[model samples]
Target: MSTEKIPQIAFNPKKNKVLGVEIISIENLMSRNQKTDHSPEKAHVLKFNMIVLFTGGESEQLVDFVWHKVSKNTVIYLTRGQVNAFKFNKNLKGYLILFTNKYLEKQLNALPQTTTIRLLTSHLFSPKIEIPKDLFIKKYFHLFYKEFYKANETHIDTSTIHHLFVILFNKLERLKTNQLPQIKNTERFSIFLKFKELLESEYAKNRNADYYAKELHITYKHLNIICKEVVHATAKQFIDDFIILQAKRALINSTDRSSNIAYAMGFEEPTNFIKYFKKRTGYTPNAFKKIHS
Candidate 1:
């Protein structure tokens, strides 16, 4: 595969308007020749709700922060908003399931099991849960992969794909629960999740703790208390971190100049953004891009 051409697709619910889900076969993404360099690069960003499965090949597996030797029948899940990179060889095979968060939302409104999986959002962390090489889960994954191919070939209805996705997700949840004792949602963690949602929607216009506190229907002091307890940072600190993350993502992905990235990230002046970035990341936007690029 031309590692340079990372295949990507966006599932816009409005356009597709399907009742069920979609699945992309990862095997279809691999080049016919199969041997390719494994170095990390900006892989494609997939925007949709989905589960991703991977079977290791000859190349060392390198995905974001996680590294492991290629093994048979290995499976990995990539939910929405998670970015990934990988290297592979001839035997690599897997599937990428794309669905809507609405499917999960209809079942459970709050982000179920997100706290356990939140480390995935960072490029520098990996889960401790391991998939046994010869376990029954592998069989289920194979079944799901077969269904995925059938779905792609129009042999199965979208509803059948949706049902498979639900079953797979439930199994994954069970695996997670077994590996890590379910983290009880403390009042603090609950507030943090709400704060995070509000941050994503209003980060551009509002960065104040009091504003978030008012919107969350909690006192500023109480909000700060929750943030400090769960995130080990004050509310303002979390806001700064969120803004810095957005700045980094825009800078890395866009062809725009540093000044343009700053303005796009809601900074009134490029210089102010530069100053803020330097304070948090110890580098200017241009400098950071150079390092990552």
Candidate 2:
């Protein structure tokens, strides 16, 4: 006569509303089950305005162009414009730090390029440091979590939270300095960073390597050499990939007509856009929307 009970599914990040630092929790964000299956479609798309920290569990084999796995006692920073997916096991326990771009921008506004904030922005989406599983890092993480929780509870007084956040940033910066060695700088690396920044700003209007070269004050040949050296891809390939990424984002986030989207993204005509998109993605824009939707 006894009825069998159904098992509960873990909390899904995709189903939840985006919360800022003022109203989020580490425990509340995680699932009770250690092992959970997640599809790429269920991956949480981080809107560019916020930062998030996640720990524990191996991620699902989803397509991630820019994802990083942190070591124990390490904190991974995800700036704007990067997306990733995760699959957590039961022992996955970590704090997810959420903050706004505006929060960091204010401080960075006064700093020069060599400063930590500005340099960090340039290396955004690139994992830079790996904190060891030492007592110092453990204590810092604990303090960060405590201060973050206190900030969430005292949501009305942001001044207190700001101070706490500054402390957190200082600790992270110290760890970054002490734990990680500097990566070698090369001409190709410098060019790649410049190209990435330019691509972010001008991907809609300019897809040609020549145009990027003009902006960077370098010849097209030099640009190509640099890109090939650093990324092992041609400048055209990088542009194509950037365009495809934008197309994918538009397809997922908007319900705009295809023609409008095409024009908005700098295509001369809808048909041309369709052709280019299909060539890169193997699906028409409409088809892409349907598949992702």
Candidate 3:
């Protein structure tokens, strides 16, 4: 896939609109433009949020360089700026809902520090959740699909769409809490979510717990407390993991040399970089390269 040519489709009212939303079955999404489009299986970055809800069948999706295997009743959420590539089964049965962040962001514009959207944008971080399909829940996707395809309104009442998303996100959050391994941790780890959000944006420039703590306007101790509460790890360890993961991504996906990568990751001493990477990953830069190669 050409990274530069990642397809990003906006809500085209002329095509289909539930006011910034569109829903298509996985079968149709795969074949909709096969005659005219090239590389339909290639990965692309999204400019809007896309939610794929599967009723049955199995498939895998690459999200931000991580591959997630999903099956029946699995829900995969992809937000703007995330790279997504699909590898679907022939009998892929699912609902693909695409919606613009523009309208949703405004309604959820309050800062993470200010209001509790209660992680309304939480899916941006935790993207996959699985729950068995029920007639009650399957109805939303059908209703959304119906509304989106039938939307002929010139000026759609966005409130209806916004309410739909609120219900959907809230329901997913509840399921995520219940279905995830550590049920109790989700309740008190709101700060952990903010930490991840900030780290994704700031990790390259700042990998220190102190910097993240300051950005979140919380004491370093408080940040560590939240990290332990949520991930059973220290804030420093999380920061290190974040930086190391970014370095690994660069090593795997980029053509840059180890020395250049070390310097780029703010390693003033190259040996420190090697030691740090080896400490966590058990592989020196060159060794990791050879293995991946």
lDDT of each: 0.61, 0.57, 0.68
Which one is best on lDDT? Answer: 3
Error of 1 at 148 (Å): 3.6
The lDDT ranking, best first, is: 3, 1, 2
- Over the stretch 172-279, how does candidate 2's per-residue lDDT look in tens digits? 556555433233555556677778888888988888889999999999998888776655678898789778887876765566777888999999999999999999
Error of 1 at 242 (Å): 1.6
Point out the higher-scoring one by TM-score: 1 or 2: 1
lDDT for each residue of candidate 3 in 77-128, tens digit (9 for 90 to 100): 8776566777866877888877786655665642232223333433225578
Q: Against the true structure, what is each candidate's TM-score?
A: 0.68, 0.62, 0.68
220: Cα error in model 1, Å: 4.4
Comparison by lDDT, 1 against 3, better one: 3
